[model samples]
Target: PAGAGQDQTFRADDEPEHGDLIVTEAGVLKVLHTPGHASNHLCFLLVDQQLLFSGDHIMQGSTVVINPPDGDMKAYIESLYELLAESVRYIAPAHGFLMGHPEAVIDFLITHRLSREHKVARALGALTPVDLKALTAKAYDDVPAAIHGLAARSALAHLLKLEAEHRAFREGDLWHAIHES
Candidate 1:
Protein backbone atom coordinates (compact mmCIF):
# COMPACT_ATOMS: atom_id res chain seq x y z
CA PRO A 1 0.00 0.00 0.00
CA ALA A 2 2.40 2.65 1.18
CA GLY A 3 5.72 1.28 -0.04
CA ALA A 4 4.71 -0.75 -3.04
CA GLY A 5 5.06 -1.21 -6.80
CA GLN A 6 3.27 2.05 -7.59
CA ASP A 7 6.60 3.85 -7.80
CA GLN A 8 7.83 1.13 -10.18
CA THR A 9 4.73 0.38 -12.28
CA PHE A 10 4.02 3.95 -13.27
CA ARG A 11 7.61 4.90 -14.02
CA ALA A 12 7.06 5.56 -17.71
CA ASP A 13 4.55 8.35 -17.16
CA ASP A 14 5.90 11.66 -18.46
CA GLU A 15 4.11 13.29 -15.55
CA PRO A 16 6.75 12.29 -12.99
CA GLU A 17 10.00 13.22 -14.73
CA HIS A 18 13.26 11.57 -13.65
CA GLY A 19 14.13 13.14 -10.31
CA ASP A 20 10.82 12.87 -8.48
CA LEU A 21 11.22 11.62 -4.95
CA ILE A 22 8.45 9.49 -3.42
CA VAL A 23 7.97 9.10 0.28
CA THR A 24 6.46 5.86 1.58
CA GLU A 25 5.72 4.32 4.92
CA ALA A 26 8.84 2.17 4.63
CA GLY A 27 11.20 5.03 3.79
CA VAL A 28 11.84 7.95 1.50
CA LEU A 29 12.65 6.66 -1.98
CA LYS A 30 13.53 8.46 -5.17
CA VAL A 31 12.36 7.37 -8.58
CA LEU A 32 15.38 7.22 -10.83
CA HIS A 33 14.58 6.16 -14.38
CA THR A 34 17.85 4.51 -15.25
CA PRO A 35 17.32 3.39 -18.80
CA GLY A 36 19.87 1.55 -21.03
CA HIS A 37 19.29 -1.78 -19.38
CA ALA A 38 15.66 -1.42 -20.34
CA SER A 39 13.36 1.37 -21.45
CA ASN A 40 11.27 1.21 -18.30
CA HIS A 41 14.09 0.43 -15.89
CA LEU A 42 13.89 2.09 -12.47
CA CYS A 43 16.10 2.16 -9.38
CA PHE A 44 14.82 3.11 -5.94
CA LEU A 45 16.93 4.82 -3.33
CA LEU A 46 15.91 3.99 0.25
CA VAL A 47 16.86 7.36 1.69
CA ASP A 48 16.71 6.65 5.38
CA GLN A 49 18.36 3.24 5.17
CA GLN A 50 20.99 4.58 2.82
CA LEU A 51 20.41 1.45 0.75
CA LEU A 52 19.77 1.49 -2.97
CA PHE A 53 17.56 -1.14 -4.52
CA SER A 54 19.23 -1.35 -7.90
CA GLY A 55 16.50 -3.53 -9.49
CA ASP A 56 17.80 -4.67 -12.88
CA HIS A 57 19.74 -1.43 -12.97
CA ILE A 58 22.84 -3.38 -11.87
CA MET A 59 24.05 -6.63 -10.39
CA GLN A 60 27.18 -8.07 -8.79
CA GLY A 61 28.25 -10.87 -11.13
CA SER A 62 26.93 -9.95 -14.56
CA THR A 63 26.75 -6.90 -16.77
CA VAL A 64 23.30 -5.44 -17.42
CA VAL A 65 22.31 -5.80 -21.06
CA ILE A 66 21.14 -2.75 -22.97
CA ASN A 67 18.51 -3.13 -25.70
CA PRO A 68 17.63 -0.39 -28.16
CA PRO A 69 14.43 1.66 -28.31
CA ASP A 70 14.07 0.94 -24.60
CA GLY A 71 17.69 1.55 -23.61
CA ASP A 72 19.93 4.60 -23.87
CA MET A 73 23.54 4.70 -22.70
CA LYS A 74 23.44 8.46 -22.32
CA ALA A 75 20.46 8.26 -19.99
CA TYR A 76 22.16 5.54 -17.98
CA ILE A 77 25.18 7.79 -17.48
CA GLU A 78 22.97 10.57 -16.24
CA SER A 79 21.30 8.20 -13.79
CA LEU A 80 24.71 7.23 -12.44
CA TYR A 81 25.50 10.84 -11.76
CA GLU A 82 22.20 11.24 -9.92
CA LEU A 83 22.92 8.25 -7.69
CA LEU A 84 26.48 9.39 -6.97
CA ALA A 85 25.19 12.65 -5.58
CA GLU A 86 22.83 10.83 -3.20
CA SER A 87 25.64 9.34 -1.09
CA VAL A 88 24.33 5.79 -1.17
CA ARG A 89 25.95 3.55 1.44
CA TYR A 90 24.91 0.12 0.19
CA ILE A 91 23.43 -1.36 -2.99
CA ALA A 92 20.93 -4.21 -2.93
CA PRO A 93 20.86 -5.27 -6.52
CA ALA A 94 18.10 -7.33 -8.09
CA HIS A 95 20.46 -10.23 -8.67
CA GLY A 96 23.51 -9.84 -6.46
CA PHE A 97 25.02 -9.44 -3.01
CA LEU A 98 24.58 -6.27 -1.02
CA MET A 99 27.35 -3.92 -2.10
CA GLY A 100 29.35 -2.34 0.70
CA HIS A 101 30.47 0.71 -1.25
CA PRO A 102 27.68 1.95 -3.47
CA GLU A 103 29.76 4.45 -5.42
CA ALA A 104 32.31 1.81 -6.38
CA VAL A 105 29.59 -0.49 -7.71
CA ILE A 106 27.98 2.28 -9.72
CA ASP A 107 31.38 3.30 -11.09
CA PHE A 108 32.16 -0.28 -12.05
CA LEU A 109 28.87 -0.75 -13.93
CA ILE A 110 29.32 2.53 -15.79
CA THR A 111 32.95 1.75 -16.67
CA HIS A 112 32.02 -1.72 -17.89
CA ARG A 113 29.34 -0.33 -20.19
CA LEU A 114 31.78 2.22 -21.57
CA SER A 115 34.23 -0.62 -22.19
CA ARG A 116 31.49 -2.44 -24.09
CA GLU A 117 31.19 0.59 -26.35
CA HIS A 118 34.92 0.33 -27.04
CA LYS A 119 34.66 -3.40 -27.66
CA VAL A 120 31.91 -2.80 -30.19
CA ALA A 121 34.25 -0.40 -31.98
CA ARG A 122 37.09 -2.91 -31.95
CA ALA A 123 34.81 -5.68 -33.19
CA LEU A 124 33.78 -3.52 -36.09
CA GLY A 125 37.43 -2.90 -36.93
CA ALA A 126 38.28 -6.61 -36.94
CA LEU A 127 35.52 -7.48 -39.35
CA THR A 128 34.69 -6.14 -42.83
CA PRO A 129 31.63 -4.57 -41.22
CA VAL A 130 29.65 -7.44 -39.71
CA ASP A 131 26.06 -7.87 -38.53
CA LEU A 132 24.70 -7.77 -34.96
CA LYS A 133 25.18 -11.51 -34.48
CA ALA A 134 28.86 -11.63 -35.33
CA LEU A 135 29.56 -8.42 -33.50
CA THR A 136 27.82 -9.75 -30.42
CA ALA A 137 30.02 -12.84 -30.47
CA LYS A 138 33.24 -10.88 -30.71
CA ALA A 139 32.25 -8.27 -28.19
CA TYR A 140 30.87 -10.73 -25.67
CA ASP A 141 33.07 -13.80 -25.93
CA ASP A 142 33.38 -13.79 -22.18
CA VAL A 143 29.70 -14.56 -21.77
CA PRO A 144 28.35 -18.08 -22.07
CA ALA A 145 27.29 -19.34 -25.50
CA ALA A 146 23.66 -19.63 -24.49
CA ILE A 147 23.62 -16.06 -23.22
CA HIS A 148 25.21 -14.58 -26.32
CA GLY A 149 21.68 -13.76 -27.33
CA LEU A 150 21.55 -11.59 -24.25
CA ALA A 151 24.91 -10.12 -25.28
CA ALA A 152 23.46 -9.43 -28.70
CA ARG A 153 20.83 -7.34 -27.04
CA SER A 154 23.51 -5.38 -25.20
CA ALA A 155 25.43 -4.93 -28.45
CA LEU A 156 22.28 -3.67 -30.08
CA ALA A 157 22.06 -1.09 -27.32
CA HIS A 158 25.48 0.31 -28.15
CA LEU A 159 24.78 0.05 -31.87
CA LEU A 160 21.54 2.00 -31.46
CA LYS A 161 23.35 4.81 -29.64
CA LEU A 162 26.14 4.69 -32.21
CA GLU A 163 23.63 4.77 -35.02
CA ALA A 164 22.01 7.76 -33.38
CA GLU A 165 25.44 9.40 -33.27
CA HIS A 166 25.98 8.43 -36.95
CA ARG A 167 28.76 5.97 -36.20
CA ALA A 168 26.90 2.78 -37.19
CA PHE A 169 24.13 1.62 -39.48
CA ARG A 170 21.58 -1.17 -39.11
CA GLU A 171 19.81 -2.82 -42.03
CA GLY A 172 17.47 -5.63 -40.88
CA ASP A 173 19.34 -7.88 -38.43
CA LEU A 174 22.68 -6.62 -39.71
CA TRP A 175 24.76 -3.63 -38.64
CA HIS A 176 27.58 -1.89 -40.54
CA ALA A 177 30.01 0.80 -39.52
CA ILE A 178 29.36 4.30 -40.77
CA HIS A 179 32.29 6.64 -41.06
CA GLU A 180 31.67 9.58 -38.76
CA SER A 181 31.30 12.84 -40.64
Candidate 2:
Protein backbone atom coordinates (compact mmCIF):
# COMPACT_ATOMS: atom_id res chain seq x y z
CA PRO A 1 0.00 0.00 0.00
CA ALA A 2 3.06 2.26 0.05
CA GLY A 3 2.87 3.31 -3.59
CA ALA A 4 -0.89 3.24 -3.67
CA GLY A 5 -1.11 6.82 -2.46
CA GLN A 6 -1.45 9.57 -5.03
CA ASP A 7 0.77 12.62 -4.66
CA GLN A 8 -1.88 14.96 -5.99
CA THR A 9 -5.61 15.37 -5.54
CA PHE A 10 -7.69 16.00 -8.63
CA ARG A 11 -10.86 18.07 -8.60
CA ALA A 12 -13.87 16.86 -10.58
CA ASP A 13 -15.50 19.76 -12.40
CA ASP A 14 -17.42 17.76 -14.99
CA GLU A 15 -19.02 14.87 -13.18
CA PRO A 16 -21.74 13.38 -15.36
CA GLU A 17 -25.30 12.91 -14.30
CA HIS A 18 -26.67 9.50 -13.33
CA GLY A 19 -27.98 8.86 -16.82
CA ASP A 20 -25.27 10.77 -18.67
CA LEU A 21 -23.79 9.03 -21.71
CA ILE A 22 -20.15 8.49 -22.62
CA VAL A 23 -20.08 7.12 -26.14
CA THR A 24 -17.08 5.08 -27.24
CA GLU A 25 -16.15 2.55 -29.93
CA ALA A 26 -17.31 -0.30 -27.74
CA GLY A 27 -20.69 1.15 -26.82
CA VAL A 28 -22.42 3.89 -24.86
CA LEU A 29 -21.46 3.84 -21.19
CA LYS A 30 -24.20 5.27 -18.97
CA VAL A 31 -22.78 6.80 -15.83
CA LEU A 32 -24.27 5.48 -12.62
CA HIS A 33 -23.58 7.20 -9.30
CA THR A 34 -23.45 4.06 -7.23
CA PRO A 35 -21.83 5.29 -4.01
CA GLY A 36 -21.81 2.70 -1.26
CA HIS A 37 -18.52 0.80 -1.15
CA ALA A 38 -17.07 4.26 -0.87
CA SER A 39 -18.69 7.66 -0.71
CA ASN A 40 -17.55 8.53 -4.22
CA HIS A 41 -17.75 5.18 -6.05
CA LEU A 42 -19.22 5.07 -9.54
CA CYS A 43 -20.21 2.38 -12.04
CA PHE A 44 -20.67 2.54 -15.78
CA LEU A 45 -23.41 0.68 -17.60
CA LEU A 46 -23.27 -0.08 -21.30
CA VAL A 47 -26.59 0.89 -22.78
CA ASP A 48 -26.86 -1.33 -25.85
CA GLN A 49 -25.44 -4.49 -24.27
CA GLN A 50 -26.71 -3.85 -20.73
CA LEU A 51 -23.32 -4.61 -19.25
CA LEU A 52 -22.12 -3.08 -15.98
CA PHE A 53 -18.57 -2.10 -15.04
CA SER A 54 -18.74 -2.55 -11.28
CA GLY A 55 -15.53 -1.35 -9.68
CA ASP A 56 -15.41 -2.48 -6.04
CA HIS A 57 -19.14 -1.86 -5.83
CA ILE A 58 -19.80 -5.52 -6.54
CA MET A 59 -17.25 -8.29 -6.25
CA GLN A 60 -17.40 -11.68 -7.93
CA GLY A 61 -17.43 -14.28 -5.14
CA SER A 62 -17.51 -11.99 -2.12
CA THR A 63 -19.68 -9.15 -0.85
CA VAL A 64 -18.34 -5.60 -0.77
CA VAL A 65 -16.85 -4.56 2.56
CA ILE A 66 -18.81 -1.57 3.89
CA ASN A 67 -16.39 -0.27 6.51
CA PRO A 68 -17.67 2.74 8.43
CA PRO A 69 -16.28 6.31 8.15
CA ASP A 70 -15.82 5.46 4.48
CA GLY A 71 -18.13 2.57 3.57
CA ASP A 72 -21.87 2.83 4.24
CA MET A 73 -24.23 -0.11 4.73
CA LYS A 74 -27.41 1.83 3.97
CA ALA A 75 -26.00 3.47 0.88
CA TYR A 76 -24.56 0.17 -0.32
CA ILE A 77 -27.94 -1.55 0.02
CA GLU A 78 -29.65 1.33 -1.75
CA SER A 79 -27.11 1.25 -4.55
CA LEU A 80 -27.62 -2.50 -5.01
CA TYR A 81 -31.36 -1.93 -5.26
CA GLU A 82 -30.71 0.85 -7.74
CA LEU A 83 -28.69 -1.57 -9.87
CA LEU A 84 -31.42 -4.18 -9.50
CA ALA A 85 -33.84 -1.64 -10.97
CA GLU A 86 -31.61 -1.34 -14.02
CA SER A 87 -31.42 -3.78 -16.92
CA VAL A 88 -28.06 -5.44 -16.31
CA ARG A 89 -27.25 -8.54 -18.36
CA TYR A 90 -23.66 -9.04 -17.24
CA ILE A 91 -21.47 -7.74 -14.44
CA ALA A 92 -17.82 -6.84 -15.16
CA PRO A 93 -16.42 -6.46 -11.70
CA ALA A 94 -12.96 -5.13 -10.94
CA HIS A 95 -11.65 -8.26 -9.18
CA GLY A 96 -13.52 -11.12 -10.84
CA PHE A 97 -14.19 -12.64 -14.22
CA LEU A 98 -17.26 -11.81 -16.30
CA MET A 99 -20.40 -13.05 -14.55
CA GLY A 100 -24.05 -13.50 -15.30
CA HIS A 101 -27.08 -13.62 -13.00
CA PRO A 102 -26.42 -10.15 -11.68
CA GLU A 103 -29.85 -9.78 -10.16
CA ALA A 104 -29.62 -12.95 -8.08
CA VAL A 105 -26.13 -12.11 -6.87
CA ILE A 106 -27.16 -8.60 -5.89
CA ASP A 107 -30.18 -9.91 -4.06
CA PHE A 108 -28.08 -12.48 -2.21
CA LEU A 109 -25.53 -9.87 -1.18
CA ILE A 110 -28.24 -7.51 0.04
CA THR A 111 -29.84 -10.26 2.06
CA HIS A 112 -26.49 -11.29 3.46
CA ARG A 113 -25.64 -7.75 4.54
CA LEU A 114 -29.05 -7.20 6.09
CA SER A 115 -28.63 -10.46 7.98
CA ARG A 116 -25.22 -9.37 9.20
CA GLU A 117 -26.64 -6.01 10.29
CA HIS A 118 -29.29 -7.85 12.25
CA LYS A 119 -26.61 -9.96 13.90
CA VAL A 120 -24.72 -6.85 14.90
CA ALA A 121 -27.86 -5.31 16.34
CA ARG A 122 -28.64 -8.43 18.33
CA ALA A 123 -25.12 -8.57 19.66
CA LEU A 124 -25.29 -4.95 20.77
CA GLY A 125 -28.65 -5.49 22.38
CA ALA A 126 -27.36 -8.46 24.34
CA LEU A 127 -24.20 -6.71 25.38
CA THR A 128 -24.87 -3.02 25.79
CA PRO A 129 -22.05 -0.66 26.77
CA VAL A 130 -19.55 -3.18 25.47
CA ASP A 131 -16.32 -2.40 23.65
CA LEU A 132 -15.93 -3.10 19.96
CA LYS A 133 -13.73 -6.16 20.49
CA ALA A 134 -16.25 -7.89 22.79
CA LEU A 135 -19.11 -6.99 20.46
CA THR A 136 -17.17 -8.27 17.47
CA ALA A 137 -16.57 -11.55 19.28
CA LYS A 138 -20.26 -11.98 20.01
CA ALA A 139 -21.47 -10.72 16.66
CA TYR A 140 -18.92 -12.61 14.62
CA ASP A 141 -18.58 -15.65 16.88
CA ASP A 142 -18.98 -17.96 13.91
CA VAL A 143 -16.07 -16.28 12.17
CA PRO A 144 -12.49 -17.43 12.65
CA ALA A 145 -10.31 -15.49 15.09
CA ALA A 146 -7.59 -15.13 12.47
CA ILE A 147 -9.81 -12.66 10.59
CA HIS A 148 -11.28 -11.03 13.65
CA GLY A 149 -9.50 -7.78 13.00
CA LEU A 150 -11.17 -7.39 9.63
CA ALA A 151 -14.37 -8.71 11.15
CA ALA A 152 -14.19 -6.06 13.86
CA ARG A 153 -13.92 -3.33 11.29
CA SER A 154 -17.12 -4.58 9.69
CA ALA A 155 -18.79 -4.86 13.10
CA LEU A 156 -17.81 -1.30 13.90
CA ALA A 157 -19.18 -0.22 10.56
CA HIS A 158 -22.52 -1.79 11.42
CA LEU A 159 -22.49 -0.07 14.79
CA LEU A 160 -21.82 3.26 13.12
CA LYS A 161 -24.68 2.58 10.77
CA LEU A 162 -26.93 1.84 13.75
CA GLU A 163 -25.82 5.07 15.35
CA ALA A 164 -26.68 6.96 12.19
CA GLU A 165 -30.17 5.43 12.27
CA HIS A 166 -30.47 6.48 15.97
CA ARG A 167 -30.88 2.84 16.99
CA ALA A 168 -27.65 2.80 18.96
CA PHE A 169 -25.05 5.08 20.51
CA ARG A 170 -21.42 5.10 21.53
CA GLU A 171 -19.93 6.41 24.78
CA GLY A 172 -16.16 6.58 24.94
CA ASP A 173 -14.85 3.24 23.61
CA LEU A 174 -18.05 1.34 24.31
CA TRP A 175 -21.24 1.11 22.22
CA HIS A 176 -24.76 0.96 23.59
CA ALA A 177 -28.20 0.09 22.23
CA ILE A 178 -30.85 2.83 22.42
CA HIS A 179 -34.34 1.91 23.60
CA GLU A 180 -36.83 4.46 22.38
CA SER A 181 -40.49 4.75 23.17
* Steric overlap count per candidate: 0, 0
lDDT of each: 0.77, 0.88
lDDT (tens digit, per residue) of candidate 2 on 34-132: 877788789999989999999999999887787767788778888999999889999999988898999988999889988999999999999998999
Q: Please, what is the TM-score per model?
A: 0.77, 0.91
Writing each residue's lDDT as its tens digit, candidate 1 over 29-131 gives 8877777567667888888898888998778888765555676776776677777887689989999798898778888877877888889977876773688
Candidate 2 lDDT (Cα, whole model)? 0.88
TM-score of candidate 1 on Cα atoms, chains taken together: 0.77
- Write down the RMSD of all candidates, one decimal each: 5.2, 2.2
Q: Which regions of candidate 2 deviate over 4 angstroms?
A: 1-4, 10-14
**Model 1: lDDT of residue 18:** 65
